[model samples]
Target: MSKVYILMGVSGVGKTTLGMMLAEELSVPFYDADNFHSASNKEKMQNGIPLTDLDREGWLGKMSSLIPEWQSSNGGVLACSALKEKYRNQLAGGIDKDLEWIFLFEDFSIIADRISKRKLHFFNPDLLKSQYDTLEPPDYGIHIKVENSPEESLKEILQKLNMPEFGIIGLGVMGKSLALNMAGKNFLVSVYNRREGELEENIAQNFVDKYSDKYQLQGFDDLKNFVFSLKSPKKILLMIKAGDPIDEIIEELIPFLKTGDLILDGGNSHFKDTERRLEKLSELGIHFLGVGISGGEDGALNGPSIMPGGSKEGYNRVKDLLGSIAAKDRLERPCCNYIGPGSSGHYVKMVHNGIEYGEMQLIAEFYYFMRYFQDRSPEAISKVFTEWNLKQISFLLEITADILLKKENNQYLLDKVLDIAGQKGTGGWTTVAALEVGVSLDTITASVFARNISAFKKHKNQVRELYKLKNKADLEITDDELFKSYRSASVINHSIGFELLRIASVEYGWNLNFSEIARIWTNGCIIRSSFMEKLSGIYDSTKSSHLLLYPDIAEKLNEDQEIFTRIIPAILSQGCPMQVCSSALNYFLSFTRENTPANLIQAQRDYFGAHTYERIDKPRGEYFHSNWKPE
Candidate 1:
């Protein structure tokens, strides 16, 4: 965190005075241009003549090249009359690449008089006119124009120019909205996006038109141009599409961007895609961020969930800015976190959607049961669903319940709805990643597969050629019993669903913090709820373990296990898919109670071609790999 105040102005302006004061306050090295000047320039200046642009070119180059070491190691202020834009531009190149420039301005007459009062110096009072003539005020830097007091200008620059921890890159819908949210709090914001259209769009949308020049939108034709648009010590984000375009964008930008520059893929990317890209990019010393953004178009245009990962160094560049922009969850924590290195952010999002699949299925199952088994009016079913949602449930579930209950144009929309549901690519992605990561996604995958099965209109038609599938018309259940069964089954589904996510975290190096993940889900993410808030709190004391081991949740399952058992048969009778849910909960309860799982036994057989078992007296002792058991 080296602060080097590079003072630029005509020779008579208060740059030297400010540089001296700034150095003393900061307690660091300070260099004056007068000391560094060549004898030729000094002789010319002493003879009441100003130095030309060409005369000062070498000096400017030297200063520009020197400051990088100072910026890297020990930094103070450099007092130089960076008279022209070209000279200042030279200072912006090479190792001085990330240099920040400051310009001190005073009226020509005001400065000439000041120079006249000065003691013996090479710069004569007569040369002030030519210095003013040479000066074309710098546009892309700090301009202090109050009085000629160096300390006053230094104070103002320190107050204003020292921006917040990080900045935003792109200024599209998501990026601009994020920037606006940050800049509203006076955070340092640097935005880059496509050059052709939407410059006005970003300005109008971000409300940055008020302070138009401050919140600059550096228009770029391509990714390389975009990278150049960012401030040095860059942290650029990719708020563009995923797939080939993301690669194209990063490939072009990588050469220009430094090792620490971040490229956030805030798209609905496949987790495996994230993993592969991050690995490739890391070799180039470039950081790749696969961030998962949920909450739809409005969410993109407003606040959204932000899951970031890949290159901890890159995230360290911009976490605070990202946090400020993300929507807050139940714990009042932002819906933003370092999801893990590489594709872990998108991986988490994939699992997030996987759980979403399960959650949606549960809702759909409840709807189907209400319609088919209970034979209740849509209104009656909606009432039941809404009432159930009044307890500590997710916003996704609660909203679904609300939507189910709502009368659309004075009619129950649920009654007129088609049975089929549409799914995007996330279902397939969740399954694919689970397979690769060795996570058991029975609940989430079953939910996704159920939707896939639903899409089989042709196959369903072909079912007429085979044995006719019998409808569950003979099944009967009481409302009290049915409601209890549905509720218990839903919990079982959720328990199993979270287990899949837990397994994914363990298998991959993605360190999914349950409390933080739950907090992020509260608002912008899909599985947001009071349940998550409570879940977040529970993980505080028991974070090392999985979500299934949360004491409160485990206790809830124990309390309701009896109810779940009684309701299981009724759920099956009602034609609901309670099988997977049942298996999940059973496995969880038994697995938590002991370590000798049947699946583990099967896994051992698969691995080593041997059957092994634990003795009753010695639970964790050597496995019994001996002869057959006596009947």
Candidate 2:
């Protein structure tokens, strides 16, 4: 998706100067319309003659012919004094390429002064009035005031197009927040939602009313008007539900879209579905982007970690816009980039959710250990979590502490919430993908299973009454020891998640950058923490297969492994199910061990099914069949 920009206005309005500056800034070529004029036309203009439409037909045709060549390459900026409506229509109307008309507006007095100072120019200052008289102000182009310096004008032009830059569908919480975020950055944003009922219309109107004064925001109830309001290379972002609703919207929007326009899905869509959509849309010459947006509602309002993947050219078209709205890390780098081709962004986000499930479950286990084994109240447990957070534990731990501290009518609010945690299926997607890729993601898998187990409240109650079990153990560990064990468990959980990403990257050809992933997650995300910053630094310097294999991480895990060993027995005896933490500990042990008992399992397979096994005496890939089954 290359784009052509035509800078248009009456003569002496500084279109050529500004067009040259814009071309230089965008790294594209610039062409002055004067260069394409016939020598006879130049001579006539030099003699203060106003050229009629007949005299301009050849010049306009030449500009129109060059459109395809520029679009096939990196695109070009052309400075032309296309004062008549018919002239602009001849130049840009019905073109297959994306052509934007940028009209540089200037006051008559300013134009007169600029022209009076101009030396060696063909157009006379006396002819300026005639030029203005012939000018038919464009109803479709971007009008930029030429009062500011060229650099400032170009800066404004790049960020704020004449028409709305984004047309956002589905005005839910995330959609509204993102619209407001883009508006706050001085972008013209058009927002829409399906007109389901009076309630839906009111919701959309309320959002527009709230921010219309502060930013250039518009709300449209009619879909056709909304689509018409957007500029070319249209970027329509869908923040609707993941499955059939998205398909429904696309089907409705296809009639309003043109070739090379982009449709970005910012929901937690299934990766396979995204891949299918990408292929389907590409057949029509439309680009479909699978964008992974994290950070929840608050993050959407402020900044969020954005992962966009689909067509590379489509990403290039919106790169600057995404960078402008994305959250910045401590180093002030935008936490957004082109993840890869196809559905890689959604895949990465799925794994992120899987890791989040593991992390939250581990925190729950820690809370249970404190509440049951140590007999600690909510406030006391919150205090411990707060202390660990100050030591750079994790954002999840920090938020958990705050959640525990929240109270209503002097009673803790968390205690009143339901025990059953709801999932939107991203965690399940990650677990399934791990199975497909032949990777071990046991800690995350256990976390997903834990959520299922929590749903069986009736079964648990019946089993508890039938057994009448009374196994209880007291934990006498110091707070420091508990904190170390928690930190070690957190590292192991993240390690498994990153290893899953590594395996999937190879299996799917995503070429995922582990360091960038850590960097982007350091802020504006649910799992953000100072630990991610450290992980980024470690990953940047080393190419370790597993995070635990990193020397610094290995040392920390080894130092805290003792604490985990001493505390697990006490915590488990009190009937606290440490699913995620216990699984992480086991995975850590298995990963570090050089040998396991899998040889016996292989022997049993060969004995029963005549399957082959590799012998120690033979080189790798050489198989031997066992005769232990009396075959």
Candidate that scores best on lDDT: 2
What would the per-residue lDDT of candidate 1 be over residues 55-169, giving only the tens digit for each residue?
7777777776777778788777888887877877776553332356778887877887888899977778887777777778754456678483556677887764654333344
Query: Candidate 1: where are CA atoms >4 Å away?
Result: 1-225, 405-423, 435-438, 461-494, 497-511, 541-543, 577-631
Assess every candidate by TM-score: 0.65, 0.79
Q: Could you give candidate 2's per-residue lDDT for residues 574-610 as a string of tens digits? A: 6768898788778877888999888999899998998
Cα error, residue 311 of model 2, in Å, equals 1.4
For residue 565, model 1's alpha carbon misses the true position, in angstroms, by 2.1
- The regions of model 2 sitting more than 4 angstroms off are 1-5, 8-161, 470-472, 541-544
Candidate 2 has an lDDT of 0.86
lDDT of each structure? Answer: 0.67, 0.86
lDDT of 1 at 549: 64
